[model samples]
Target: MKKLGLILSFAAALLFIACKTNPFTGKQTLALVSNSQIFPMSFQQYNQFLSENKVVKGTAEADMVKRVGQRIAIAAEKYLNANGYQGYLEGYQWDYNLVQDDQVNAWCMPGGKIVVYTGLLPVAQTEAGIAAVMGHEVAHALANHGQQRMSAGMLQQIGAVAGNVIIDDPRTLNAFNQAYGIGTTVGVMLPFSRGHETEADQIGLYLMAIAGYNPDEAANLWLRMKANSGGQEPPEFLSTHPATDSRIANIRKMAPAAKAEAAKFGVTSFK
Candidate 1:
């Protein structure tokens, strides 16, 4: 039994080593879950969410969500194709909906399912603002941030398992599991979320530009976001997004470059 356990551990370690590559950053990442498995589960959950939620019908806001989502999706495709990632979206089933919620939040699930809450409409005061939010959400999907997060969790789990193997005392193992689980959730996951937020910001800038929305508006939109939220947020270390000041500064720095990128696709301004 011990020999079999040793063989299993060795195989698991080998699998971990084989799956290490950051899809967006192009750095070595520790990923134990494969997208082939993750995508199906995400799609299932997204469909369930749609079924459970009150999806807004043919309203102007809903229409706008679909239109903007399509444009951003196209922009992602064009960008990826131009960069030699021709079939990057092959398995993606893109769907966008406006949910009649008062929460100032929006998110894109893996495999391109998106939901925008009605409460955000005021903050997204214009078509450009909607594009900004949608682009940012879609960027999270395109960048596979969800997958990376799940992968990171799996790595943390593997670490916990290794710790259990090393520690013989049952009490020690239980304590280690509890501590590791909490640490992974609060420490590793929170930072991973912040990284996702930053990546989405960068990619969203370029996507909105390519979709012909003014990249400059992104900063203003975030400013509005800050105002709408009443400036309430956790400390920078605990939050999943950068503080408003940092976000505004980063967006300002990236806007010009995003505009330049849009120009490459012959998009100077929106219709």
Candidate 2:
């Protein structure tokens, strides 16, 4: 048991050393699972999802999702390249699809696999509004939030195992697993998800602006989302995103700066 504990400690230390700085936030982040591993899995899962789901075809909304996705992807590439992170998206197989689902949700998997549900279209009333949502999702992928979450889960698992081994009691082991599971799932994962949402909001605003969309529309888009959700939300700390009020306020604060950034790219307006 002592030797096992030593092995686990060594592994955890190795994971700690594997941290990398996130480009968008410039924060050191754990990433025990590499993109090389995560991206291919994401691509396969995306392909499977498309094959099994009702993917929109030959429709205006479908086209809009693809268009917005491409624009955001281009903006991401430009941003990374300009920041001396060239080829950051080289292995990314960017694909966007509009699914015929009523849930107002959108997500971007690692390696740029994105899905925008049809229910979100009405809320994202215009191209720019759709761009706001798409940019946010893309930012989550680029920031590697998924990888960080996975790494954190692994560490939690290691800790739980060590605790069980040291306690040497089945009841104690069960309690340890249950506690660790909830702590990692609800406490850690939820907050991490919320952080990703906030980061995405910030990065998405800039991306939409660089792609020639008025960043101000981002706040409006959230307003629409809030209305769509019927104003019911989990507490800010427990939820995967900031309260709608907070998000709108943040977007309002950032809009002028985003526009200034767009001006550098010769974009004066979105009209």
TM-score of every candidate:
0.88, 0.92
* Model 2 clashing residue pairs (backbone): none
- Give candidate 1 regions above 4 Å deviation: 1-25, 28-31, 169-179, 182-187
Candidates' lDDT values, in order? 0.83, 0.86
State model 2's lDDT.
Answer: 0.86
Most accurate candidate by TM-score? 2
lDDT of 1: 0.83
lDDT (Cα, 0-100) at 139 in candidate 2: 86
Report the lDDT tens digits of candidate 1 across residue range 1-271: 5754775677578566746443345666545566677789988998898889899989999999899999999999888887777887888899999998999888988788899999999888988998999999988877777777776766676677677767889998999899988888778788788877888898999899999999889899999989888998889887877888899999999999899989999998763
Candidate 2 lDDT, 1-271, residue by residue in tens: 8767696977778677879888877899998989999988999989999999999988988898898899888888877887888978878988899999999889999999999999888898999988998988898899898888888777777777677668777887888788878877778778787777788888898899988888999999999999988999988877877899998998899889888877877778883
Report the error of model 1 at residue 90, Å. 0.5
Sequence-dependent TM-score of model 2: 0.92
